[model samples]
Target chain A: DTAVSQTPKYLVTQMGNDKSIKCEQNLGHDTMYWYKQDSKKFLKIMFSYNNKELIINETVPNRFSPKSPDKAHLNLHINSLELGDSAVYFCASSQGAGNNEKLFFGSGTQLSVL
Target chain B: AQKVTQAQTEISVVEKEDVTLDCVYETRDTTYYLFWYKQPPSGELVFLIRRNSFDEQNEISGRYSWNFQKSTSSFNFTITASQVVDSAVYFCAPSAAGNKLTFGGGTRVLVKP
Candidate 1:
């Protein structure tokens, strides 16, 4: 069984369109995170939620929004997608919101904006 | 700010050869955690190892080993007798006071037969 799973393994859309990528973890973790991997292979944290409460919000654009309905789910929605938004988005979770806890990552959603 | 740097963008090695991936991190916190992840072409990230700042011991797991040195702020991963399946993008991430992680520019390794 997959500990963390995200939908739409591959997403292709045109610029200016909107899209959402859903993620869920069966590990019963309290903290979830969304990370973006750029075309250059540089990974950056976008947002983090602990037990459905917003915790860490990075310098990401307002067009991107993260929604965590519960501790086990975190969904990312992008409005008016841009070409630069084409990247692999990963969802991760850990038992606690601490540096000491190792995160469990999901198979990334490869988003491609044309 | 927490930072993790993987200087080498990519490394190529022949089969059965040994390879080392270097990682450097910057954190002001006295205690921290360093992690390594491997993302194969399949797109799933596999957690490799986690090293706490207080523990300076080097760890070995079968063909994989990690060298963590706090003085130099470096955590390097060495692979013994690499195989084609070992080819993947390796990421070094370090977390400090915050719950989030600062990931390095991944180092892609290519193993040839």
Candidate 2:
């Protein structure tokens, strides 16, 4: 079974289009995170939710919002995407909010804005 | 602030050769956690190893080994007899309790067979 899965493995849209990526984890983890990997392969944290509560919010733009319906699911919604929004978005989950816990990541959703 | 630095941006090695990926971290907190993650072409991030600040001992598993040195604030990973399957991008992340991880610029490894 896939411990963490994200829908729409690939997304290509024009500028100003809004799109959402859905993520689900069956590991029963309490914390979920969204990370962005740019062209340089630098992984940066965008947001984190612990038990459906927002725990970490980076310097991401307001157009980017994360919704965690429950502890098992966390989705990312990007509005008015721009060229800079093209990157790989990854969904990860851990047993808890502790830094010691290992993260289980999904296959990732590649977003491309033209 | 916690920061992890991977000096090696990319490394290429032949099969059966040994390669080492260097990682240096800085954190104000005395107690923190360090981790190494591998991201292959498939895009899935695989957890390799995790070490706490208090533990300075080195660890090895099969052909993979990790060296942790709190004095120098370094946690390095080494692969012996590397296979082509080991080609991937690896990240070094360090974090404190209840805080988000700070990942370093990944190091891409390519092992030619």
Candidate 3:
């Protein structure tokens, strides 16, 4: 069984189109996160939810929003996607909100804004 | 502020050759956690190892070994007898507080048979 999974493995949309990526984890973790990997392969944290509560919100624009219906799911929605939004979005989960805990990541959703 | 730096951008080696990926970090907090993650072409991030600040001991798991040095704020990963399956992009991440992780630029390793 895949511990962490995300849908829409590949997405290609227009510049002004909006898209959403769904993520689910069966690890029964309390914390879930969304990370963005740019062309340089630099992974940056976008948002984190601990038990459905917003914890960390980076400098990401308001266009990108993360919603976690429960501890097992965290979905990312991007509004008016731009060229810069073309990157790999990864979903991850951990046992708790502790910094030392290991994280299990999904295969990732590749978003391409044309 | 916490930062993880991976100096090597890419490393290519023949099969069975050992390779060491360097990681240096800077953080104000005395207590933090360091981690190593591998991302193959499949785009899945695989957790390799994790080391807490208090644990400076070196650990070995099969062909993978990690060295954590608090004195230099460095946590390095070494792979012995690397195979083609070992080719991947490795990231060094350090988490300070609130479970926030800062990932390095990553080092891509290509193992040629």
Indicate which candidate wins on TM-score: 3
Please give the DockQ score of every candidate, comma-separated.
0.78, 0.80, 0.89
In order, the first chain's TM-score in every candidate is 0.98, 0.99, 0.98
Each candidate's TM vs. the true structure? 0.96, 0.97, 0.98
Error of 1 at B46 (Å): 0.9
Q: CAPRI band of model 2?
A: medium
Please provide, for model 2 over A38-111, each residue's C-alpha lDDT reduced to its tens digit, 9 standing for 90 to 100.
Answer: 98888999999999999899899999999998899999999999999999999999999997989999999999
Tens digit per residue, CA lDDT, model 3, B21-65: 999999998888899999998889999988899978999999999
Q: Judge candidate 1 against the unseen true structure and give its global Cα lDDT, from 0 to 1.
A: 0.92
**Interface RMSD (one decimal) of model 1:** 1.2
**Candidate 1 lDDT by residue in tens digits, A1-114:** 999999989999999999999999999899999999888888898999988998999999999999988888999999999999999999999898988888889989999999
Q: What is the i-RMS of every prediction?
A: 1.2, 1.3, 0.7
Q: Which portions of model 2 show Cα errors greater than 4 Å?
A: none
DockQ of 1: 0.78
TM-score of chain A of 3: 0.98
Q: Residue B53 lDDT in model 3?
A: 92
DockQ of prediction 3: 0.89
Residue range with the least summed lDDT across 10 consecutive positions in model 3 chain A = A94-103
Give the Cα error of residue B44 in candidate 1, in Å. 1.1
